[model samples]
Target: MTRNFNYWSQKGVKGPSPSPMFGNILSYFITPRPHLNMQWQKLYGKIYGVYNGNKPVLMVAEPELIKQICVKDFHIFSDRNTNRRIHPILSKHLVVETGDDWKRIRSIVTPTFSSSKMKKMYPMIRQCLDDFIVELDVYAKDKGDVNVKIMYGNYTMDVISRCAFATKTNSHKDPNDPFIINAQKVFAPKVSRALCFMLLPTFVLKAFNMRGIAEESANEFFFNITRHVMKTRSNSQKKYNDFIELLMNAQKSSTNNNTKDVNHYDENDSSEAHHVNEGEEEKQVENKILSSVDKYITEEEILAQSWVFFVAGYETTATTLTFASYELALNQDSQQRLYEEEEKQAENKILSSVDKYITEEEILAQSWVFFVAGYETTATTLTFASYELALNQDSQQRLYEEVMTAVDSKGEIDYDILARLPYLDAVISETLRLHSPAIILIRQASEDYKLGDTGITLKKGQQLEIPIYAVHHNEEFYEKPNDFIPNRFLPENRHNIKPYSYIPFGAGPRNCIGMRFALMEAKLALAQVIKRYRFFRSPNTDVPLLLNKSTILHSPKRINYPFGAGPRNCIGMRFGLMEAKLALAQVIRRYRFFQTPNTDVPLQLNVSLAIRTPKRVIIGIEKRL
Candidate 1:
């Protein structure tokens, strides 16, 4: 039966009219609101409506309403609203699952990303960074400017590939590894899925059985690499303290328990009479054994979780680091400050260490640049921050003073020290506000729930999304919303901001888990870069950055500043920032960055599978001393 209702429209709360055939179809593809989605909210108000011919989906902007739907009444919206047909290609991993399966998977995987585990992976991260620095030194040997974006991407890809997956992607040397190639294919925006198919019901898509690009080869490649590593480790009985080792140990424990359970059941005979004590004893043994075994993870489950980590980590971080270099090239002042901080940090480390010198792990932990999370988002933020700084010198100077004074007094930079610099924090925050990389935080509704005032129920098994861009740019929340202003995020002014008004990482139970990492990276990278270079408007840079609306992450049409935002945001955010800061500091300490007539200030940005510059940022680097 066809269902129709006036719903919220009856109460004068206006929204986009629901269209059965082409419900916001054109807008979904052509204009993805690269910067912000406030225009829609202004036109439609808090409660908006959309229909993909069959399903009625509402876009709610009110924070309280979103909280209620996502948290308070989660049961009704428990199931994910995606096309289950794609499960084969896009495995039902933790990111897409719901209910008991999600609960179980999350429980098993949560420990993998704990603080202790990340600390253990620090050495691996530094190894990748060292390799990256060597590569950079080679490129900069001729004193020729390098494409920072590509360099950073290669660095990040190598780091995550080795650290997360326990495999070598060598994206630095071979850009076309099957693993990388397949990942790009899988994540690439499918025109049908983004437009027509995204709205189609899961049942409808499954009935037709639409197959995505065959991932058999990619899966085989990854699986074999994992299997071989596992076998070798088992054979040697050697243990390396890494994520892969943990997974292997977990798998072994699970297998042993399973074997014991089978043997116990087999031993029990139905016809044999047993005493009450014997039965109780058996039950106690079973309970104890199962309890111990249940804590271990399975091989299949590990592969799925680990592979997702690899795929998600590599692509996002690479894109972010690339964008960050683009920003450093443009914003010389910010770059210079960052470089100065690095020098001071290096000097302080050398002076403080008596006999036992600072190891790579110590460097990684202390260097905030390497710990920040959102690489792409932060890089983009830097790009935009540079643009705004160049455009508004007063704000730039204010930020410089804040960073320099703090570093000068402390002798070395610390996370808490950096946090106290209100202006710098505000500038970073403001940049994020203006150019958030992720536009939509996609999640399947856990269950059915009613939206505010709109009595219509959002049924289970429906895909739900929070329009991050829209929330950040809402004029109702931010004054002169489109214009860049650092003061808006200043201490006194920040109180006016709404609860969910700025969710680059999202909110509620499933917010981006790596927010701290991203922030640390950004702070460190920016600190080092700004210490040496002085950014000025270049002819290559477009006065007003033209955003590429095609890709999932918001990217510039030219090489802009780099940095991304959010929680489950970017794990290597800190690492990317430190790398950027180190590179800038090293170069700027020796040279002055100036825009030649040929320099691309508003350079064209290439928005492909990853964020890139249209061409290498051309600038004249002159020796300072």
Candidate 2:
């Protein structure tokens, strides 16, 4: 791989000089990936290459080229480079699946996320948020330093478990509950790191029953619990309206399908192989794959996907809320105005689409997709929105007034009132642009593709990395790219922004499936919070926040713009947003947040992943008087 660095340079792929085991990591140590990518673009033009690990990754931010690859040439770059064909149930999970299997599974699972389904799940989410508020209220009365991240995480996990898995337990009250404990173990960084170990291949890891990739004890407990749950459901006379019911239907269909396939195949064929032509053989294979969809969504598959859902939803939502709490604490005037004006309006209504009467496995997989794509990113946006609001008071005040007016005219906030609060929406949009949850977007090439006008081609088997932070902060796309300005996304200024320059939930068909859900969640949460409490700077508050790494005072790129764009954007974007917005709304209306002795102002963000979460954002609380 080191040998190919010069080879790429000869082919007009100009980038940084790689050094030893560090490769370009030292440059990342200097700055974030996006900033470094933007710098490289200036040195070697827009279309360039840089070494990440042992591979040379193409980094391009120009819109037209992005459009061609993500929209037009999607088929050639249909799969993600990280999509290895591993053995675990994780491999069967859609996030990493490529080509036909991906398409097939996607089709089946799409319906479970439809507006109607989300509507059914809304009550559960609301219940979770309500429970969350109760806890916050206690903290406010006690004047305790609230660790909102942990609180929000527990809240989100409860909601996902209820709506997605048909279980309800207060995770915060009983931290040792199997659901909470195993979830931590399964999604722990060590487990994730273990999964990435090249030495422990998927089959070997599975064969040896290594708990490193997935905690064996936790996995077994969950599997047993699921089996029992299913058995109880089978005997129960009452029907349920949650995800469990939807998946159980799929399980029934799968059971019926396996029986039919076994019987039909035997009676219809004398010989299985020698007599068939290539075309006939292809048809058989296709039919078998479809049959397997039903066949696989069994008890084992259901349990596997439930873990996926738990792992994805648990932390991401909690972390984002924590950040928002911090931001609200720092910007008291804006918080005060929001409290005065927004005693107010709006329900959330999202546009467009998800699935057929999909199989049990497919439905379960889709739920996982919803959780993974939706939760953390939405939470991060809420965090950033709070941060920016604290930093930029005028925008926060404007949004607060708008929310107040809408609520004054209408009843309690619902989607209708939310529609009138454009400034509020704008604030959320700006936050997403600046602190998009997903960090780097990646794609693999199945065929060689060309860069627009540059004539430099990306070869088959090559990978491309889009530096989200760089593009979002690039001066070319946004004026005063580093500033926290919500007006940039106002209707008048929105159209002037370059195409693909502002993808918070990404762009294209393969973009985040849950985009609208996340948006709805964030808007609602912010609206409620803005109206109830005044967030003011305290002794613990730090001015001009800092990421975990060094603070780059003068960023070279455009302003705002986050999430990713393209065929493989986050799938559960809307769902996550909805949860975040609602949760924030409920808490803000009831209590005021303040900086505490424990509050770490000018937060040091964790640079390990894309989301800019603080190592800790402990905040003080007071019941709004």
Report every candidate's CA lDDT.
Answer: 0.44, 0.52
Number of the top TM-score candidate: 2
Candidate 2 residue-wise lDDT, 1-625, digit = tens: 3656575678767788987644565565455544455577777766777775566778877766766666566667667765245534445445666766665554344344445555556666766666766665666665665445455556766766676566787976888887767656654446234424423445665566553455567555555555556678887878766655656665566435434332111111111110011133323433443444423343434444444444444444444444554455554444444443344332232222211234444444444444444444444455555544544444444455555554533324554344334455555555555655555667788978776678777888888866666677778888887665656665566667777777655544445545434544555566655555433334443433334321111110100114455545544544555555555554455455565444454554544334444434455556655
TM-score of 2: 0.79
lDDT of 1 at 267: 21
lDDT of 1: 0.44
TM-score of each model, paired residue for residue? 0.69, 0.79
Model 2 misplacement above 4 A: 25-46, 142-145, 191-231, 234-240, 249-308, 323-360, 367-371, 397-412, 415-420, 542-563, 591-601, 618-622
Question: What C-alpha lDDT, on a 0 to 100 scale, does residue 28 get in candidate 1?
Answer: 44
By lDDT, the best candidate is: 2
Our model 1 lands, by Cα RMSD against the true structure, at 12.5
